[model samples]
Target: MRKERILYIYPTLSSFIKGDAEILSREYEVTHFRVHPTSWHSLLRSLISQLFHLIFNLRKYDIVYIWFADYHSFLPTLFCKRFKKRCYIVAGGYDVCREKKYGYGSFTNPIRGFMTARSIKNCTTVIAVSKNIKQIIRHVFPSTNCVTIYNGVVLKPGKEDVEKESLVLTVSMASTAKNVFIKGIDRIIEVADLMQETKFILIGTERQLLEKIGYKIPDNLQVLGFVDHSHLQEIYSKSKVYCQLSRRESFCLALAEAMLYNCNPVITNIGGMPEVTGKNGFIINEYSAQNCSFVIKKALEAKTNSLGRERILSEFTIETRAEKILNLLESN
Candidate 1:
């Protein structure tokens, strides 16, 4: 039997997409399409390129696997349905989320929502990253075929050997006020204020935005702008605790990666975070600075072990995800 040819569509070449794509390539003849645009000009150019590519070559492939139900996947999914080709759409967190405060989600924006809905309706299957997402899709489109599949993580084998400091860490794309609030940056700041003795390292873009908002960076908190994975690995090795107090998440890649470095997690009780933490880490029952501080303080005192890494190796590794996905694709 011949291997199936798949057209893999993604919004961006994000870490989340790359991890799964690496494994997907091994099983199928994958043609990866990155539709994330950097500017308005590039957006138009890329769409034109995609339209031409699909119009000419879409029939050559057997499956159209869309990573996110955004504009990029809309056209290809439509094409697949029109031509009666097998296609599935993978729901990344934001695409299927319906958060009122964030003012954005797959079904939040009128125009974008229509495109997303159409894409979902057209596809044969909707692979949600978490149980929460699966529930949301089933509630909205009760007849849609939605399945839960956890995103994969890159495994770092053999327990982390670095001696952990009293360092508490968090990583996010907190460049704006909305992002800060949505990512629980304010809560982290408040926790840092209360816990003067504990050192907090927040790694993300836009450290200056916090200053502008008069956040008054406490002496205990040090905001380091974006660092690549290599530097992140170094920080993760030295850190005793990792915090992800986000308002919502599909599947937090950072929390999983941090776990591989043996950093105990202190995350908010929302979205797919709990699934990622499993029973290995502490969960913040409330979305408050006081609650987050309590969890972090408690987590810091706990003995560090391979429990976090073990969780990833057993249930969330790239190979594990790939095998499940390959089996599902082959089933049809």
Candidate 2:
């Protein structure tokens, strides 16, 4: 039997997006399309390109799968509706949010909000990365079809002989001042300052970005920018705790990745984080540095075991996500 052909569209090729493409490829002929736009000129060019591409080639694919509902998603969803094709959009965090404080989320801008809302409503189904995101979508567009599918991770074998250290880690793609607060880098820095004895490693952001925010970095907190997957796994294996003190997060993949290495999580009670942490880790209700520091101490003293890894294995494995995604796509 011939497999269905799927057109996968995304703004950026993140790991999670790539994972979904790989999953669909097992049962479908997948074609990847990137619609990343950096400037106004590029945005215009991208829109023209997407319109022409779909106009000519959309009928070649049986289904259209998009990673996020944004400007890039607008044309695809609109075209799918016109052509009477099945279109599924994965709503990760920002697409469903309107966090005005930090100027984050798709709805923060009026034009972008309009496009995002239309894309979400017109799409055949919205695949929410968390129940929190699904609730947000249902609240805004009550009649839109939505489903909760937690993002999954591939489980890595634990190094039983390897010993964890007194290191706390966090990963965020924060570069500006607003993102510092949004991703809670400021809070992490404060906690690192307070607990001078413990070492904190922050991956995915530059030290200069933090410095520009008028904050002094403590010797204990190491800002290693971005590390490759192998190095990240090595760090995860050695770290004792993983922290995410974000003001807003839809679903944090880093926290899950850390937990897979048996790194006990210390995260804020925001978005899908508490849902991800469950009873396997610690949750901080307050965002203050003193409060976060206190929670970190508790996480540091907690017993070390495979509970974190076990939770991920049972609930958020790639195989489980693949099965669920295929079922959703194949069913009515």
Of the candidates shown, which would achieve the greatest TM-score relative to the real structure? Answer: 2
Report lDDT per candidate: 0.84, 0.90
Winner by lDDT:
2
lDDT of 1 by residue, 1-332 (tens): 78889988886787778877877788889998777556778877778889999999998999988888877778888899899998998897778766676875767777778888888889999999888889888998898988888888764653466788999999987667777888888888888999999999999856689988777889999998888877888888899999988887778888888998899999988888898889988988877777778889889999888877888888888788888888889887
Candidate 2: segments with Cα more than 4 A from true spot:
none
Q: For residue 322, what is the lDDT in candidate 1?
A: 89
Report how far residue 262 has shifted in candidate 2, in Å.
1.3
Give residue 40's lDDT in candidate 1 (0 to 100): 74
Per-candidate TM equals 0.93, 0.97
Give the per-residue Cα lDDT of candidate 2 at 53.
93
Worst 10 residues of 1 by lDDT: 153-162
Off by over 4 Å in 1: 39-41, 158-161, 212-214
